[model samples]
Target: MRTKQAVAAFAVLLALAATSCDDGDGQAASGNSQASAAGNGGQGALGSDGDGTDGDGTVAGGGEAQLASVAGADELIRLISNVTTCESPSTDPEDTTFTGVDDTSSETAVGQESATNAEWGIEERATCDGEDGSANGHQLIVVSDMARFEAAFKARQEEEIAAGEGDTRTRWFVGKNFAARIYATDSEERDMLSLGTLGLNCAPGYTAPPNSTTQDALVDGCVLTDFVDA
Candidate 1:
């Protein structure tokens, strides 16, 4: 896990954006709390990646970071496709299809300038409509303005701490232009595992709740590893 303060700050930003999207008239979330920061995803500190500058720096690569002005709904789907290339083709060869990114933007929040600005990319819901799903599969939310986003989250964390409502369990893993909010039903179930030579948190052997939704099952059982690079 990264740190209590950093995770708290990230959670604050994600929670606010997710809430705004969930409540918008035209957009509907799949009722998965794990994707929300205040929910399962909001717990833990970010793990160290050792690739950063100084002590900690932005995760880089994947072309230049898209400008905040151009990081709107129009670019969201492409970004998702570019960033999310981690499907399990070896484990579940039949489920190799990556679903198209859905634009849940309401009419009032359809573009870069809308009150619900589209700089906050869309989420990949946990539930799958067809066969072949991995319990490790997790929904993702990407945002623009990495620096501002982190700053805002940090500010919110300060406010919450001052109010005596600090969350010590929030963890975050961020890269140059992307930040991911991971979810897990139980904190104890999370483990740092290795694939090939790279080590990552999130391993097998998780149990999901009965009647769990896709995202619920995912967060409950699978490793919510970070896919984007630094």
Candidate 2:
């Protein structure tokens, strides 16, 4: 009886060891299979998870909608009127005193000594219509003592440049009377859309009407600090 009991106990121990080995082998194989499946799925491959992408072969990434340019000068006027102080067009406009390195033209004038030399406001100035008629171009005339605006604009330009913008050139001019900055445009003549000390001094290739003075050109029809490119 003692011998039989000992033999039974040995058999039970062997059975337990075999069960433990089988469980460990099954667990390892299951782990490897799961790891392989995860590695093969979506590892830089086109996604098939209905994620609204070209990966599912439906459509490309959602495209941006396009917008049209402002139609006429009046539309542009309406757009700007809400932001700037708009008054009846100035009957007489004078060149503001600008002191800066001009990237547009070589003409420079002595700073006007008077405080009332030029006023900063938006005026409905007449400009060429490109066809035969004339269009009312609302000119935002920026004058001296505009340090805050210039600082804000310059800071923004620097921030954009630091953020990898390589397409723009910002040139600032400082004068005793006032300072100015011109942003380059893609126009043929590299027309500038500028803000500050606008006047005949800023007008390089642009000429006023045949009978207009350099000063009256602002009111008549001139492109000093003009934003339009023909």
Candidate 3:
């Protein structure tokens, strides 16, 4: 009976040891699974491109340095003036040749002179040289406020249609704080001033020419804003 009891005790010890080993293995497997899941989650947070831009092209953290060195209106004007085709770019604060307003007039008068000047506190025109070594009639209007300028631009288009002026053939290349009335003498000059030197692109689902009413088509589409101030 003593031998049988001793044998029974030994059998119990073996069973307990097996159970403890099984439990340890299970715990280890669970820990490994948890670690793997955590690693996958980290990757998912980075998005597909891993450049902080999501798969759907949503930029993370406002997308730094995306404006290609254009930070303000001055920089944008410089960019326009620096076009290879531009021989002599001159800026005039009181010039109203384009808008047909007097230089001695106030901002209100300037606004009344043309629909394009409705919202600009300051309207400076920058003229550059054409391919023929003459004034190309290309105009760049630098404004104080982008929002007001865009609103005025859209309203002007509507007014033109309502008053029998037809579609304004004037193509405007707009940025964060400026607009370019593209009348370049040639395609090369137009491309350089509009998209080549400025590093601009069309907004999604929008194009130039006919769709010039919205900010997406006019400003956001043409100006790279990653460098501009919000």
Candidate 4:
């Protein structure tokens, strides 16, 4: 009977050992699962694909969207018109500063095909305070066909250069479908108008070639800044 009792005790020990091992394995599996879940949570916080891109492939922040905000003529005009401190010159429309240009004019025409263009003049005393004085006024041109406009613009520049009338002192801000000829004598006013108001990026001594297309011109020297609606 004692021997039988010893054997039963040994069996009980074995069963207990097996149960302990099973419990340890289950605990380890649970820990691993929790760790995997935590890792997945971290990835989810970073982005869907572990990068800064959303599920739709767009960047998480406004980086891609802002860069893609290429403004056309209407958008450009709206942005310029939102400037409350400064007033643009207008002859026909007293309230609006936009003056319709003759599409047939060489300076206003875009390409062989017809395109609409409008000009906005910014004088030194056009601001509210009337302190931003410049010897020459600034000009903004909004065009329908930027590509064709760029081509024609280069031709005009070539003609001016050939005639020895090329005014290199004038700073130009070339956008996607708009251009700003900044002649503000005041540096602060120029910055306020070009960089602050219009959000243009200019490169000194950089001009697109006469034969360059709009894409080529933008790649070479032209800048297309972000256009935020007012």
lDDT of 1 by residue, 1-230 (tens): 56998999999999999888768733434344345634522543332444321222322221112122223322422333332333322212122111112233333222422222232232221222112243544333344544444444454445555677644233433333343333333221122111101111222332222221111111222222222222
Residue ranges of candidate 2 with Cα displaced over 4 Å: 42-230
The true-structure Cα RMSD of candidate 4 reads: 14.7
TM-score of each: 0.28, 0.20, 0.44, 0.36
Clashing pairs in 2: none
Kindly indicate the candidate among 3 and 4 with the higher TM-score: 3
lDDT of 3: 0.48
> Which candidate leads in lDDT?
3
Write candidate 2's Cα lDDT for 1-230 as tens digits: 99999999999999999999999999999998888756644123332445423442222233211111233335443433332333443323233222221111323332322222323221222111111122322332233333333443344444545677522322322222232232222341122222222222222233333322222222322212222332
Candidate 1 residue spans exceeding 4 A from truth: 1-139, 185-230
Candidates arranged by lDDT, highest first: 3, 4, 2, 1
As a whole number from 0 to 100, the lDDT of residue 84 in candidate 4 is 22
List the candidate 3 regions with Cα displacement exceeding 4 Å.
Answer: 1-77, 81-84, 93-96, 99-118, 121-123, 133-136, 168-170, 189-230
Candidate 2, backbone clash total: 0
lDDT of each: 0.32, 0.33, 0.48, 0.40
lDDT of 1 at 99: 19
